[model samples]
Target: MAVLLVGTVVVLPSPQSTLAAWTATEYGRGSLQAGTVNPPTNLQCSAGVLTPPTFTWTLPAAGGLTRTGFTWSLSGGFTGGGTLGATATSVTVPGGLLGIGSGTFRLVANGPGGWTSTPVTGTLGMLTAILYSCSVP
Candidate 1:
């Protein structure tokens, strides 16, 4: 009489199957561009008491984003006291806010994606004399 013995073996998958199943991938990043704003040139004031001085400016091209808005600062004791249009590139200083003194004024434009343009400064002064001359009284 003869006796024979056989053995069988089984293999199991790794416990980290979910982590190994993920594959590597490549991704691209977007770029944020900057924009610019033209400074106000040839500023002039009016003699009329309630008339405000007007300042004009040109909008510069933005790389690939839209212009959000603009901020203005005045010198010569001038105060900004008006609302600007959504796309307005011009502003007028109230009569009562001007004629205080002579100084510099600046403006800057805000672009999309938190980008700002170079500030534009100008030599701003009273183009016209005060409406009420103290010497007259």
Candidate 2:
């Protein structure tokens, strides 16, 4: 039930369904850092008026797991792909992805995981949602 917080990085506590097990992990976690990565915030398009707009965002405050990639998507005409690497803070997607209308975009973080369904402290792994939402005009 304890949130795995390290400095500015904040990993989410276990979901309601996983409480009992997570509670124990919290106590034994020590340095394991087993938990969901908190979402990044403040997604923006620095140059929306131009083709191949550049997207940017503020990374999560805290999560011990290193982000291996980033996935982006939206409800607009765009079908985004995971073209961004772990360290990429900004990227220029294809032209016409961002139409004139406004819509919300989503981005999620990915990392190595031993468990596909869960993130354990055993090694670098697990990612479902470190997915953050953002909007642009």
Candidate 3:
């Protein structure tokens, strides 16, 4: 409201804002080829569950175009595993160096700048055969 004081016109200042606006620049982005590449799906464990564990899975059709390598690991039963080239679709974790009973397995796709795909995991049952399938069959 405005007021006229003794022939003089007076006006009030509007309220001040408490917040301020700022600007920033984007640095990067993340991707998984629409969930088709990293942490390959359709994981399958061969009939060999005794000596060591051999696991395989499917990757995106363009997997070789992006992925550099694959990392596999076995936990729960013991603690052992290794990395393989992108050309290979399966991994055979060495005997936990010290293992027993059932266990768990994990896999991931290796990428640049500490980039890794979502992990694929599964339970590992007890060994059923003396001759492992990863190395022999």
Q: lDDT per residue, candidate 3, 7-97, as tens digits?
A: 7678999999877766776677786553334567678776453556568788735643378788887677467778888777887666534
TM-score of candidate 2 relative to the true fold: 0.47
Clashes of each: 0, 7, 2
Among all candidates shown, the one with the greatest TM-score: 3
State in Å the error of residue 77, model 3.
3.8
Worst 10 residues of 2 by lDDT: 119-128
> Over the stretch 57-84, how does candidate 2's per-residue lDDT look in tens digits?
6765575466666666554444544546
- Estimate the TM-score for candidate 3: 0.57
Predicted model with the maximum lDDT: 3
TM-scores for candidates 1 onward, in order:
0.49, 0.47, 0.57
Off by over 4 Å in 3: 1-37, 49-51, 61-65, 96-98, 127-137
Error of 2 at 3 (Å): 82
Alpha-carbon runs more than 4 Å astray in model 2: 1-33, 96-103, 114-137
